[model samples]
Target chain A: MATLKDVAKLAGLTTSTVSRVINNRGYISENTRKKVDDAMKDLNYHPNEAARSLRMKSTNTIGLIVPHVSHPYFAEMISNLEARAYEKGYKILLCNSQCIHEREEEYIRMCINHKVAGIILCSGSVALDVFDGVDVPVITIERFLDNRTASIECDNKQGGALAAEKLIECGCKHLLHVGNIGTLSMPADMRTEGFREVCERKKIPFVEIYTEDTQYYRMEYDEMLENVLQKYPETDGMFVNSDVIAAQTLQTCRKFHISVPDQLKIIGFDDTNIAQLTTPQLTTIHQPVKEMAEIAINLLNDSVAGKLVAKRTVLPVNLIERETT
Target chain B: MATLKDVAKLAGLTTSTVSRVINNRGYISENTRKKVDDAMKDLNYHPNEAARSLRMKSTNTIGLIVPHVSHPYFAEMISNLEARAYEKGYKILLCNSQCIHEREEEYIRMCINHKVAGIILCSGSVALDVFDGVDVPVITIERFLDNRTASIECDNKQGGALAAEKLIECGCKHLLHVGNIGTLSMPADMRTEGFREVCERKKIPFVEIYTEDTQYYRMEYDEMLENVLQKYPETDGMFVNSDVIAAQTLQTCRKFHISVPDQLKIIGFDDTNIAQLTTPQLTTIHQPVKEMAEIAINLLNDSVAGKLVAKRTVLPVNLIERETT
Candidate 1:
């Protein structure tokens, strides 16, 4: 229940100016409008008029914000989510953030303006501050944003440890970890920590490499993988953040005449469709993607229905042994 | 420009009943609402009230309907389309049809209700009849719905023929063409036709196989590919419908101990990210996905501006040789 006064105070602006921005009645510059909008979002302030109208009607739609649907992981998640949401008589408003911060913020504002019943944020780059004043119910996937918002995530730490153990069990001497550029912001970074801990416990040597490019596409991953292999030719075990990257790593290994399993054992996270498509089918961590998607939709529905839901729901992950290992 | 009278006439209902459904002003039954909505859609009936209000203010949004974002081809298309649309100061409201007829129809109605400036339909399952009374501008991708609606597609026939020629040039004896169940609806079906034509002209024997399941997910595709390989053990050259399937074909080949390019020279359409991810990088038809996406968005914008856009805009496709063939 943040008020316009609170928004004005947070933005350091006059109440009248905030009201004008809310009504869109005055000649306001783009900067002022953005500041006001940002303040309102930070305050999670809902204009009384909009809030009352939104309550009076049911939109039967939920907003979904993902980094990019073109990415296999998000695409599969969205597919399962949309099907489940449709079964429950709701449609999804898909917002592709494309890993762009400003676009992600814009989509959040648009979702509120359109009166979506709730929002599901799958984009990890979005900062927690942006959700400070969001009025609608939010369910975050994989990323922990706030103490109030509900989040559903697979056990990244456990999965990473499982990968490390499996690779070690295969007698892989040297290990390598490939991570994303913005790795620290995401809870998935727990995977790297888990791997490191397991390697240290086993007294095995390991090297870590991260791509300079963003996580939205996998093209740059192959180049980075090549550089890593060149720098650390003895790397016999590799743990990639995603199956997409692992697939690229496999392709790069083929070019270098590196034999899989015999010479190197590779494990990937998120056993998506691409995992099986790899030459020596990827031995990877299998997250309950469909189940997680179903739970996310239900959580949104529960929040929309004013039910008290858990703030964090962590699902278990398992290792799937395939030809690569 | 269709009137309420036309919709009422088409639905064999009174104007008042149709008006009630349109405005949601009365307690209308689900059956009656559906009939009224269907009739309005059939007549391409633009509700005058919605049109008038929409013209007064720009919505800055466009509706995009695809079979499913999980499908790599569509996912990439959406990624490019959204980026281009954003550059043009517009946002996309994504609708995933999931090959459900009713869902596709419902999304159309929802888009109309949202007052989107235009729509881009990439779902092949959507019937041409549904667009009869669509009020907003529409640009179809790959599917040619009507004379009035604009469409963007790659040269599927040329791409298919190229696959046939490449496989033949690689000294393959037998050939197979894998297709989707809804082949007739999509212009991409021309790939199959072209492959067949080239095979016949070259005096090469070929077989065609199609999955009964829809094209959204690859589970059925794997099953179908297994059955195809089992039935057609002598299949040496294959021209699959998409790179996703090509990747699957490679995986299945591995399971059956059939080496690609040596035992079976294979080519696929839509050289997506997964194409390169495969070990023997897919030798396939490369459609200008990004350019096509940009054109589709521009066509929608043109239509929204009442500009004379072409009915069909076919982009060229090229064969990119890698390791498979």
Candidate 2:
């Protein structure tokens, strides 16, 4: 195992200064910290946990709790988060909770027990009881609760408004909204509220189709889309829940001969890679994932450094016009 | 910091039995081992590495090296490999080698220094000269590197033959195969060779498009597919290299009024999830990913457990005909 002595030798720093930098004590300059961390990563050195505990105390690592890393949305979010966190010189230990809220709560407790610098929660926004109990700094994504700590998210209301306005401008008179909105999820509420407000403002008639349950992410969604299209044959424009749903909706539309942007103008949210790979492509709302991830990591860094984090960090959203709308 | 004593106490076992079970040294029964491991996982018990080193002297973890996990081909492979490895009681530490020879070399060295039980080389069919120096068991996927250790893969030539046969059955006459054929890679050669040989048997003229260098993996393939269609207006069949390329081709066909299976018959290799999600769906060769992954992990585990590995395991492939054919 490489020690502080070897790291100091490689970083060209005195043992005391290396200790100061690693420990975040003795008022060491920022340059020394970079040199020390670069040397450590190069050396593939993991400081002894007990020894570091006795010396500097914290490992400066943050744990990110995501439901699944393989899903497109979470994968894109994690890629952005990883890039931003790597730029900030923090190593991320990603835990795939796999939608088990109890498992997510366990990981949170585990990170706290391991003295992780901070925690970023992205899995379940419905469970506030667990997050409220967390004593350490917690950064959230796409949801906020009780004005605790920090959160970075795109303006979901603005995103929903953009989708509504685009579909309206595309001459979609008979409109329908398809989504799963059974829970008190903040982002969902914001989006639906903005959508309803826009419809009221325009005095356009619209119908909302809520998916079966609050737990509906992507399981059995292709069937649900088929049913929605079959039930609403006269619907001209549909603002489906996500890009995944929008892609499936387009497939269903083709099955029923509802030509897109002519007979039907469809819009989705998230603007993930799946949106681009669609045949006509997707005119969806773009969540500033990279910027939000960067902000989340920055807030975690600040909180870990014993600085105050902003109550809410709001990023902008934009409408990406492709072939769908 | 729960130790063997805590775990054994919780599981109603002696510390020595728990230690033996964890180390896999002595003849502890399976029932006892299962009980001990369950208790450990339940109580978040992590074993002492140094203590295990003094006894068995090997970390019971394997390193899985892949090019990128975001790609559907490798992502499906990783999922299969992880499930197989986890079933065999081995934790996989993923290393994304980015398909660079230097990165592969570096990760091999990293795996060695970390004393992982074995390494599963998925991306790079590493040169024998590079791995001959490493003092660990290596399992290479998708290759038959003769005179080396164990290798397990699906039959690529048979898969290619099936693809050609499917397209031919769809009444495709003027067809083209898009892939690579060179001294460096064997899979692409096998596929193209199988395709050409079949076309020769049928006395049908065929065109070949090759991807140069690492461009086969990520080459902005939509434009390439469009260019191919533009060049070969009479072409009615496509034997794509992978499922991703096939998906892109399938999506591109919709733009030109070229209906899949009606005007053009397309066959994709690697029956990944994307194959089922495509609009017309895909008739592709299923490369027994689960069986191949299980055999690879089995070879690695058998080698690490001081048992002889089955040399040059070959699994079968099948053509799944869906709407595309």
Candidate 3:
């Protein structure tokens, strides 16, 4: 087996420099890093990460627990996080908790056992006690577990307000907001609150309906949305908390023979791929998914390095105007 | 730190039994496993995976490299793969290559250096030499790198033929097939072959159009699709290789004022979330993604255990008929 010395000799670098590059330590230029990487590849030399991690007491791995990646939002988030983590010489240990609290707890325990550098929790579980004894840095996305846990989330409240404002500006008289039902308070619930606040201030009569957790998991809201449309026949505008639900709303509108933008203007949160794929393409509140992911990874990295990071990060959202409005 | 002996004493089991459960080396009953797990959790005992992996010469980690998880198809695939791997006591190191060959190679080398038990390559890279000196077992999904490499793929040819037949049965006159362009031959190329054979047999006039790699990466085919639709104005039935492209075709049809299921029928591949989220709910060829993932993991496990495994396993596909048909 080739050693670090062989790789250094091949790359025309010192042993210490090669070691620093291998461990991803302080300041290595990109050109020099590339040279070392190529030399390591050419020599088929692989520094045993197990031994190195044992000595350093941490692996170049980050644990990312998400409810599920099948959702376009989380899917895109994972793509961005994984890419960013890789650029930082870190690998992501992916955990799909499927919104199960026990599963989420198990994954956290597993990450701790593996001595991951940090954990990024996006599972939507409100159980704050899961991180009771975890020593690793924990950064959350969209879910604020406790006061101490670092979180990176988009401006969901502003997103909601933006959607409501867009609908009203499009000549909507009676407005409706569809949101998910949660037992405990979550940062995402602010979306509904912001929408409600905007509607009240604007003096626009609006109704709110919450879908059960089952609907969110199954990614089906056609029946609930159809029922909402039936109950509120005068609803001229709708703002859904998620693009998936909003897309279903569009289908429901088609089923009821209601034309979008003409009869019922609609807006959705989480400008995921579904927003663009829908016919009359959905107008939506665009969450900075990539930016949030990058920030979350950086925060986790900083926290792992014993650098102080802000407890909360809220990036702004944008109103994406499309055919729906 | 709580020692293994303490955990064994707390669980009322021998240290050897606790070690067995921790290492996942030998069979243990569910009741005993639960007891050990509970006792460890109560004691806050975390078995150092780095030390264990060093002793065993392999870590309980599987490197999963996909083109991009942002794509709903790969997203769902990663979800299934991660869930199944976790069930088998393995963590997934997610690497999204974005279809970049150099990045894919780098990730592969990193996985090897990290001593992953196996690698699941879902990236659509055809470079055969990248795996020349890889010591770990590699299982490719959807791409066949070489004859010796193990691969788990869906019956692309059958999927293609099914879509073609479904479109023909829907009373479409002229047929159009949209596929991706690739320099090297791949198992996915069989999809086009199957479609071509069915068209030749049916004596249906069909035209094939290929999208560039850039389009695939960008996940946008609007302009190319629009051009195709304009050039082939007589085409009424379309079969797109992916749901993303098919969704774009739907948008293009809407742009052209072409009514679906009335003036045209479209069938999509992969049956991802996009298929269902589309306004008309795309009819698609459903690849058994979960089953394929499960099989691939099991095959990798078997290979790692020095058990005989098949070189190629092709699962069947089903045509999901929806509003588009």
Candidate 4:
């Protein structure tokens, strides 16, 4: 590893002058800057970001905590977020909590200790009081922790309504909404609310089934979905809360010899890659993942700069009609 | 935001004693350590990792660069790697290079500047000279660069041979092997070699098709796959290199009305989530991703400790029988 002294000696300059050139702390002539740059390049010198961050009391890094990276939705979100953050001269400290409370807490504390510029929380099981005494700017996606933390989420209510309306338009008589357990009271609960309201207003019979917390964590809904199908043989259409579940529903329908789009029209949420990979393809609600990621990064940056940001930001969702409907 | 001095004041101890307790440096009485810990909790104190890292000249972080995080194969790898690294008390600095040389270069420089303990490279398109002068231990997965850099990969050739043997046993008369462009010479190229050797030894007719670099990065192989099917309509069995491409192949087969496992048996590689999400569930080769990740981290740690580690580590792969075959 080459040090500042080596570069300075090679460039025939003082160590302080070289430091100023590297840090851009003071103005230097173009000729002197080029000389220092060439010298550093020749020596393969990289300035220590740890020392620089300590002096600046901050780092060009953001801590992003998600429940699981292997999930299609979070995987897509992380990809978009990493690209957007890199575009703005930032890096991501990736943390996969796997929905463990203690792990999430440890990651949060680690971010604070490292003096990260901000944190983006996309984990589902984080408690509301987790950010009570945190000093760094915290922004969450698809999760509303509390009134103090800024949040960005797609319009879950509108998404649910869109799915219901699409199913009804397809002549679905009895509707089913598969969702997360209602006890969490998450922003996603709005999805069920929207689905039920649309069904009731149109005088259509509907039922909502909540999945256990374990199902969400394991990303498996096959057994539960099979039971749902067996219990509701009269169900003409179904709206699944996530594409992962919707994909499984497609498989389950096959097992029961129920044809999709013919016997039971299906619509999924979060138009991730899994939607298109299914056999008949899936009609889904697009969550505006790329746009939401961009907005989340911008909001974190603004909050870190001491600017007052909106408490809650909701973007619109649209229905994508595919072969399933 | 509470400083060491604040914790010391609250604990009724000198700053030196509090610092010793926080760093776990020189021995301190259990009673004094308890008082310091309680005060830190009360004051909500978080030690500055940046300052500590500066003093130690290394950070408890590993840089992980992958071509695309959204791809199911990489997504699962990342999830496993993060969990393993967390157990070892290290964080991951994630970089989605998207196969751009400049972005990969920038990430490598950033990791070096931050003084990460090691780097795990899972990217497909990185140049061999990228790590020419990198100071940290560089480990490659599924891609072999130079002898100087350590590499870890599953037994890809054996995976390819297994896929071929299974398709033969399933009563396939003709075969096809789909793979990446051969110019890159990645460790995954052995898949093609193994497939071809099996077909030749069995005296079975087979064809090999290579996807363009653009197709690999975009994760879309519909058009090319459509061409392959049309060109080789007699092909009764196929082995795709990755589960992502295999999923797309399944959809393409549907478009052409080709029945899977009846008229044409199919086997995919990597056994990622996409394999299960697809209808008929792909029968494919399973890479030991978790084991590979654990070994990669261990090798990096040992190399960083100045221990002589193996230049190349290869783990075994197994065939998972699903519905497709």
Pairs in steric clash, model 3:
none
Please say which candidate is ahead in DockQ: 1 or 3: 3
lDDT of 4 by residue, A1-325 (tens): 7899999999999999998886655468889988897897778888989989988868889999998899999999999999999976679999998877778887998898788888999986576565666778888898868755589989999999998899999999999999876556678889988998899999999988998767887789999998888898999999999999999999899989999989999999999998999988999999999999999998887887789898899999999999889
Best by DockQ: 3
Error of 2 at A259 (Å): 3.0
Query: What docking class should model 3 receive?
Result: high
Which stretches of model 4 miss by more than 4 angstroms?
A1-40, A125-129, B1-39, B125-129
Q: Ten residues in a row with the worst lDDT in model 4 chain A? A: A124-133
Q: Which stretches in model 1 have alpha-carbon errors above 4 Å?
A: A1-58, A213-218, B1-58, B215-219
Clashing pairs in 2: none
- Report the TM-score of the second chain of model 3 against its true counterpart: 0.96
- Superposed by TM-score, candidate 2 places the C-alpha of residue B251 at a distance from the truth, in angstroms, of 4.4
TM-scores, in order shown?
A: 0.81, 0.78, 0.96, 0.91
lDDT of 2 by residue, B70-123 (tens): 666676676677667655656555666656666666566556544567888876
Instruction: Please identify model 3 stretches exceeding 4 Å from their true place.
Output: A147-149, B147-149
User: For model 4, what is the alpha-carbon lDDT of residue A255?
Assistant: 88
Q: What does the lDDT come to for candidate 3?
A: 0.88
Tens-place lDDT per residue, model 1, A1-325, is 7787899988889999988776545388788878887886565554533233344443556888888778888888988988888766566778878667777876776666566678999885676655554567889998767654599999999988999999999998999998656544778888888898999999999998766546444345766788889999999999998898888888889889999978999999899888888888999999999999999989887887779888899999999999888
CAPRI-style class, candidate 4: medium
- Clashes in model 4: which pairs? none
- By TM-score, who's the top model here? 3
lDDT of 2 by residue, A124-206 (tens): 66356554434567898986556568877778788778888888888888889875556536565577777888988998788
TM-score of 3: 0.96
